[model samples]
Target: MVTYNTMIHGFCKKGDLYTARRVLDRMKDSKDCLPSTVTYTTLIDGYCKKGELEEAMKCMSEMNKQGCLPGLFTYNALIRGSFNKGDIKNAQKVFDEMTCKRDIITYNTMIHGFCNNGDNYAQKVFDEMTCKRDIITYNTMIHGFCKNGDNYAQKVFDEMTCNRNMITYNTMIHGLVKKGDLDTARRFGLNEG
Candidate 1:
């Protein structure tokens, strides 16, 4: 059963949500094994990745109807989907719904959503996080700002409390290169060293 679910996830990753849904339908009817949260979340993620939020929400509904609770991973996928759809409001709703289970990833996804939306709202979310901010949070904000042509990514990078990694440096460097700011990128690398 887990193998079948894994197959579904693989199908979803390939953007073949149709086959994934078919596999899921079969999994739902299986008498030997009930569908697990991981199973539903995987489908949701696949649909979300494909920017099929309607289908993603349907999967969320089905997951709930089947008595499986959506985890932070599930919500993160949904939030990301909403962001892709340019629906930060929906992402916030999902974030708010996650009162207890909101983790660093949750906040990071929200921050990324806001950054992608070009709203600079990630700052508010970042400032309000109860969970310890991690490197992904910093990287996402930096990437988002850089991606959106916001000049404040440097501030975000400077303010990061979490340990920086290659991805973080690479994202900043990528941003600087994209902005034709090689000198700053080199300077950033120098400052880090």
Candidate 2:
């Protein structure tokens, strides 16, 4: 199984999905080893990174048919793939399907996706997240709001009294500078320094 997975990973890494699929088929036919969730997830991630979403979805279906339930990484890959393809509808569908199983990564992915597309749904996802927000989650929201020219970035920044990383400081400063508030940016920078 490890050998088969390594072969699949190698082919997928090379973007030779044809060979990857062939390896998967060979794994399916192997009597001693079967494809695991990791195997399917790797192939699915490869397809997603290549923007071959149809093939990724097919791999997902095959994973399910094989009685291997998709895990958090699997769902995250699908959501990111949909977002990368600018298929917001499909991204939302996948997100909605995750329902009760969403972690901070899922919410962060959705936030980043919506923000990258200049969509306002980032806030909705941010507000809807029930899980504990990591620094990545906060940074993503701050960056998104800043990108959208929304004041919510400052609000989020101010809320992070304890967990502010360099990224948080830089993003807030950059946003202020971009908004033509150089005085505020300078002051914020000086205070942080």
lDDT of 1 by residue, 34-104 (tens): 78889999999998888899899899999999999888789999998998988778888888887356787
Return the lDDT, model 2, position 96: 88
TM-score on alpha carbons, each prediction: 0.76, 0.90
Return the lDDT, model 1, position 28: 78
User: For candidate 2, what is the lDDT?
Assistant: 0.89
Question: Model 1 segments beyond 4 Å from truth?
Answer: 142-158, 163-193
Clashes of each: 0, 0
Best by TM-score: 2
Steric clash pairs (candidate 2): none
CA RMSD of each candidate after superposition: 3.6, 2.0
The window of 10 residues in a row where model 1 has the poorest summed lDDT is 184-193
Badly placed stretches (over 4 Å) of model 2 are: none
